[model samples]
Target: MAEAYPLKFQENHKSHWARTLRNLGLAYHQIGDNTQALDYAKHALDIYARLAQDKPKRFEPDWAMSLNDYANLLSDKGDNTQALDYCKQALNIRERLAQDKSEDFESDWAMSLNNYANRLSDNGDSTQVLACAKQSLDIYARLAQDKPKRFEPDWAISLSNYAIRLSDNGDSTQALTCAKQALDIRERLAQNQPERFEPGWAMSLSNYANALSENGDNAQAIDFAKQALDIYARLAQDKPERFEPGWAASLNNYATYLSDNGDSTQALVYAKKALDIYARLAESNPKKRTADAERSQLNVAMLAWLITGAELVVSAEAAPDSALDYDRRPNRFYRHVLLAWAANDPAHAANALENAWQAWGAMSKAQQKNWENIFLLACGFAAARAALPPAFGTWQVQLTQFKTRRKAGLPQWMEEIARRKGFALV
Candidate 1:
């Protein structure tokens, strides 16, 4: 269709040409080709801007639309500064047009406001973000009341956005209310047109879950997160290019909820899955996926630390006080100890180990029994005992006996330490 227009027609019908370029940009963006999308969007905006300058009355709206689309492409490329500038320009035009022709342009005005609010959020202007989002919600609410079929989805989206803003601002009660309302509308919409509305329904579910978690209903939050994950998983299986990002996001959210509910082991599994997807995505769209990948990587690391720490403590608790048996150690424990030793950064490692030891010391016996309360302490104690100077004489004696019994099987460093008297590993 784009090739249907010859150079002569393109020169004569610039508006049509620009629209085609904008649409091509959208097509590329939908398939995750951000570089191509950005190129096409730039060209469309350039043409639209020139046309609007010559005939503002006829071309201003189209120019604003192109500006908005270009802003979105910029945002996907992590060019927030440029995106925000374009959003402001688009909103200015849309706002003026809506005032002059409210019936025809009100929706565009509201949509622009929403876009502006999001850009403000990306820039950390929380106060303006909420104000603009609220204004957008008000307009959408009125429009939806009068024309449910046409405006309900927009209204629901605004509600979800508003809910997130409210939650971020420490208004959990109001956030939950708005989230539930959005979820209700999306649920009804999906009931009638699953293919068209299910993605929105999944998004609403995720938003509602976040609200629920904020309100301290972690169980319910996990349930809703699971629902969102299930939907995204199915959708991504069919259209990975379109849905994988959502699927990865849902997995991350689900992992968070699970961690909050005291299932760090399970959380680690899902967090790793999220990290894998985000890492793969970052390879193709680093600007868009880098932050997500970094966040997922952090989640994975923290969860692994806690789980591994707990396991180390549990294994130590089962060992005899007379001797630390090398054969009794779990592979995870051995791997962790070996890794810490190999890193050879004793100062920082010692500090972390000491902090963990102090934390374990501070815990009550009952709290100690709940490994979650002393996982770090246990991990610290095991690492310090295995790789550092003898902090406890009894453990040092046990270590000496264990090393003597397992000299042939010990790691090179440990065997070397056992061969020398009063030699510390760190």
Candidate 2:
């Protein structure tokens, strides 16, 4: 193909050459070789740009398509800023083309709007995200009504995207509805054509799981997450490069639902699996996977801490009146502790320490010992200085005495977690 591309260029078949380049880019992207995909997409876009400038009417659509392809490649590489710029260019061209020939280009225009909305999401513009997503969904819904077979899949996808934005905006009820609708369509499609639609069905299941989880339906969330994980596991076994990311994501979501359902031990196992996959992915594409790896690592650490009964005690002590309010207290306490240690937020740390100190006075000897062990496990000494309250002098002496009496370092698991979390043990 490389040898033939030069021949096509020499013969003045530049359009053909560019189209082949774009196709090659798509191929590489499908296989998850984003580096190669981006390189090919860039070349294709350059050729298309030159051709479109010379003959706008004849080549502009192709050029816009190339821009969209390039944008997708850039997005996959974690270059969101550049991706948004290119996506806007594609949307502008497609919008104008659709205005002149709606019958021929309206679908393309709607697709570009969806892509633009996705780019806006990466930029954190919630207002514009919902606006663009709504516009795309409206267009897709109309198109699907007119031609169900031709446009139903796109409509379903638009519904899923719109659902996410709705959920993010705190419209959980509507988001759940949209997610369920999308899943219904995909389910029917998969039933009719499993080979072509099963992947999409699995994706819809994952999205539905998220919506359910957001609505506090942990049991249903876990069920859907498991189904999605099962499908992704099979797909990844057959095509690891193309499907492992999705599989890892499903594992991460499944772990969260399990933890929420009071299965921290099982959650830890799945979280570790997700972290392993993301870490391996980061080795090859740090820009794209590093954040995911870090997030999964944090999830693994949180689940491990929960399994150790630290979060339970922290929740109970942090809110004695509402000790059973496991969700809010544990997360709030954990956040304050991390902020104290990582960001040196004196106010939050002081508050957390004061609460812990008060709780310590009320505990039995066995509970006191457990609390001491948990304090060490949480690396409380690392934040003790930053979190010193009015009684810090006495507390510091007490901590020092405890440390000396123990005369032992952090447990191996705690040490590894500290290393991953970038925490220094004194």
Candidate 3:
């Protein structure tokens, strides 16, 4: 098509060529070839921008849409700064277009707002997250009221985003309300059109489960999480390459819930599975999947530590000093639970701490140094469990020393934990 068309000509052929380029870009994005996606998207956007600048009435919408697609690819590639700029440009154009042609551009405006909100949330701009999310929800709500068949799905999506923002802001009750509303809408949509809406339904179910878990409804949370897992399992069976990441994420959430519920063995299984999936994904697309892969690895390591802690707490048994069954990291929840359990069963605290410390000492110097933050965190947990506040303070002092002496390579999680626990990190 590009060969057949002289792009310099003022004809509809340019529009056709641009559409083809844009579709190719979108296809590459869907298949996770983000490099090619960005290449094609930028080329399409260049043409659309030229056309829109030449004749705004005919090509402005296309230009805005191309901007949106480019922004989405950039966002997927973790370039939120560039993504936000492109998304803002798209939003400005869509807002202006909607003001003149509400019926034609209202949906586009809502979509652009959603994209902007997502980028803002990724950047942790909490103040702007709620504003963009709420505005997007309001627009979608009005549009869905007027055209349910056309806009309800978008409205449901906006509700989910708003619910996440609310959850992050610590409004668990309202977040659950919004999540449930989105779930109900998705359920209805899926019942009427399963093939078209099942994926959305599953995603909403996962979000709803997270909200329920945050609200302390563990039983109900597992029910919804399992439902989402079931759906994603089927979807991934059909298209593993496309849906496996979602499946792995759902598994991770379920594993966290199970871990909190004291199902250590099952939680370990789920965590390992999630880590395996993320490892494969990272191998295929390291640039995009490395963060998730590393986080999933951390989850697996935490689960291993939790299992060891739980067994130590329950069996009142000590492992050999040289055992390597568990990594020497401290999980906040697991450590807290062990401390609480030791409060009632004081007899095992000394043995558990001794064995855990020995296990750490058995590790190679490189491994111990590699996990210095985790080692300090574990020491703090042990000291707190032993009713030795001074010992915990000593560990914190050591952490401060490490931060002061070593200017880099310190784990950010240690600083966050210190800040959250009212301890001075620096």
Candidate 4:
């Protein structure tokens, strides 16, 4: 442009002026000039906003994204009051686009909702966050169920987020259900998707690993996290700037698993590595970095230090015969229970709840209710069955007593399990 024009006055025609201004604005933004970035983005927004179109306000997701990015820049510059207003405006536009029948881009709509919801969630607005998360999940669920191969990764993340929200609400059982869905999706996702084709697969695997650690099976979780970290590490090695955060996150997840699975020594070692990467990242202030990025880096550093200071790693003992052995009739619901447990990282008898629920849900309405009774009993027993270490000498007597009591279609048994945290039956 400079070679052609040689002077701004020579290229001051409307189109030429707009083009030069937009390009210069982008150049300014790339150099960390938030003021100019915001100005240029707004100028572009005004142009796009003013241009009339024949169609009824169709999808303008890119505009929303631009606005959102601009808001992030403003927010970073300590103008969150203005930033919040811009985000609200962008969100309203996306919501409008999502609702318009002619511009029903479900995937884009879901992405917009998820992004805005995550921002809202981080902003300490739980009410709006969950509402938007649910809306996004509903859309993603429909898409995933219809085309699992295309959208399973997204489905997994949304379900995981939803389950976490439910757990936060103290509805652990339902949370488990959602967690299982996410884990199952991720497990399926981790297989066969070529690295070149599905880059996000590694992130899905990492989330699965985290969910597993939370569920109480950190050993298994470690394996999954290792798988993810291996992939991410390679990616980071190939492209450090783009993949550093992911690699760092994977390290943090792996360290967490080690800590949970009774290997604090190794956990601390890895945690410190993550901290080093985070510290360097904080200093550099790399391109496209957000406040959330800084917070994440700080949080990882904090968690790593806090965890390393602890001398003894705590161990969890699962109930006896509580986890259904994976062999018998491992149908979908059987997988379902395992998936549910993945939400919190606890493994039950793969056979027990999965097969039971499969039978229960398959049965007629009357049969469903009957089987539900059995499920409740099994769930209660599962809690007791897991917690009794070998030192609990009365194991046989307790198991016998619990099963017998459960056979009586008793509510007390379920209430007890709910108290212990297997399925939150209460």
Best by TM-score: 3
Full candidate order by TM-score, most accurate first:
3, 1, 2, 4
As for model 2, its CA RMSD to the true structure in angstroms is 14.0
TM-score of each: 0.69, 0.68, 0.70, 0.54
Candidate 4 residues lying further than 4 Å off, grouped into runs, are: 1-39, 52-62, 72-84, 146-153, 167-180, 186-190, 196-199, 215-217, 260-262, 279-426
Worst 10 residues of 1 by lDDT: 322-331
Residue-level lDDT tens digits of model 1 in 1-426: 465768556555898888899999998887667789989999999998988887788889999999999998887665668999999999999999999999999999999999998888766677888999999999999999999999999999999999877765557789999999999999999999999999999999999997787676778989999999999999999999889999999998998778767687898899999999989998987655655675576557656755664322211122223222211112223323333332336664455445344443433322332222123223334544564334533544444433343222223323232222223432
CA lDDT of each prediction against the hidden true structure: 0.73, 0.73, 0.73, 0.55
Colliding residue pairs in candidate 2: none
Clash numbers, per candidate: 0, 0, 0, 19
lDDT by residue for model 3 (56-146), tens: 9889999999999999888776566798899999999999999999999988998898888877775657788788889989999999999
Score residue 284 of candidate 1 by CA lDDT. 87
- Please list the residue runs of candidate 1 whose C-alpha ends up more than 4 Å from where it truly belongs after superposition: 1-12, 27-36, 279-294, 310-426
Give the better candidate number (3 or 4) by lDDT.
Answer: 3
